[model samples]
Target: MTFKGVHRLLLLVFMGLALAGCQTEDTPAKPQFVSTTSDSRNSNYFIEFRSRYALSYGHTYVVFGRTDGSGQMINPEVAGLHPKSTSAVPYVIGHFVPVPAETGWSDGDLEEPYRSASWRVMLSQAEYNKVVRKIRDLQANSKFWQAALYNCNAFTGDVARSMGYSVPPIQLRPQEFVTKLREMNEGRRSVSPSRVLTAS
Candidate 1:
């Protein structure tokens, strides 16, 4: 082969190697969603639009209504309850809702008046992972709930925001946040709370 031809072949080989290196360097690994196997019943949960709500570790799993029409957090031991065919399925509400303090009210007064209502939502493993990741991210960054109140519901809203969902103000009343989540989940384009209120 001529010297010039040999030089051209070397250049081509060098270019190929550089291209291969660039491709390898630019490729990103597939993102792995959070683990679903950690909790067994996670898969059966259905994603649905309902009244807005939140989830947290403290209010891990709760039965929101009667067994005939209720939802519970996914757990390894108990199969989650859903709405009966004949009845409206009770929601699987998260623990993120804040519990109000009892202010000198009688037990009877507290029992009927202050009981918070909840709705349910079931999420697939991927969706659950997304929510979990968002929550962890917010917990790592914020102090709003650290000292004043440990509002899981607000934390859940923060997570929702991280997942690209429009959320109400981070400092909103629990009912308002719930209203916003419900609205957003139902394909509504509601205004997000001002970003100023969210934790940095």
Candidate 2:
């Protein structure tokens, strides 16, 4: 009713709008996960921790898939037997690299994940989307991979951490990293072979 009262109300409205804008700017409002499908046969999913000895150091990667046998590797490399390899599976795979060679987190099938320890993880469509989003966010700026700093195993650990799993230290060797994930995955359903797949 009074001029001063009207002025005060206008100020409060301006402040509220400013705060709302800031909140929107600070938040990355991407879809809070992925497709919302509840198909029982397709909903059962798991994360596979894969590793292999390479040039004395070793390599590691992560694979996400369902247990309904819907995903399969097409022309999966037979390891040492192939000069080049790729997968035809619909699963999501993440790879971290070193400099001058596309270093950092990138999406693609790991060339022959020779030995692996895979464990089942129950995730709703939203949770799976969240995990994928986190991986992309973390890997986007991870361009420089250092021996003591960033590497494939480190990438794997970060993905696990993003998904609310306890991860081992990044310094662990590839085999140790897989073992640690397997240990943490204890009691969870597994879609991988009971025996670790070793290179023949």
Candidate 3:
């Protein structure tokens, strides 16, 4: 192809991406997950580890259910640790001291546009209900977010642990945390990471 032809192709690609980004800048994208359970019929329950960009470092959360949509559409349940106030002040303060936290969904969490990585695992009906109960208990008990102590990653780890999954050290960033969780439990069953994270 001529130089002009190549240039035009690249321009079109860039423009298409730009338009797509703008359209989703304020909306949540629907989540599409493929269950790892061999028996798709019996495995209607699932929990997905997800990561997305955030101002401090990044954020990680879980989306659960047999939901067919996201945002307000399917309204799948989500759990993550985040400052109760959306303002940046409390978050910055939390680095040194614990601040109020909310354990449920936050804006953009259900959206795929901001996601960096995802790993999903299927669960049996009994396990699914148990995990949901654990999540709710954690939310009620967890009232603060502290960077060095308890934060989003810690919150996620606690939820995964209830399902008998081996959890990495909570100091790692959100993206790394979810990636490591999946790697540790590769067989769709609770297992261990090849190497544990000793330090951040």
Q: Which candidate should be chosen as best, given lDDT against the real structure? A: 3
My TM-score estimates for the predictions, one after another, are 0.35, 0.51, 0.72
Candidate number that wins on TM-score, 1 or 3: 3
lDDT of 1 by residue, 18-46 (tens): 23312311112112111112232335543
Clashing pairs in 1: 46-122, 83-89, 91-120, 92-120, 96-152, 96-153
Query: Highest TM-score among the candidates is held by which one?
Result: 3
Candidate lDDT (C-alpha), each:
0.32, 0.44, 0.68
Worst ten in a row by lDDT for model 1: 56-65
**Full-model lDDT, candidate 1:** 0.32
Deviation in Å, model 2, residue 191 alpha carbon: 17
TM-score quality measure for candidate 2: 0.51
Please say which candidate is ahead in TM-score: 1 or 2. Answer: 2
lDDT of 3 by residue, 1-200 (tens): 99999988866664443233223221232243333443333456777788786655578888877644331224468999888997999977776568999998998887666786677666566666777888889989999987767878889989888766778867666666677777776564541233221210
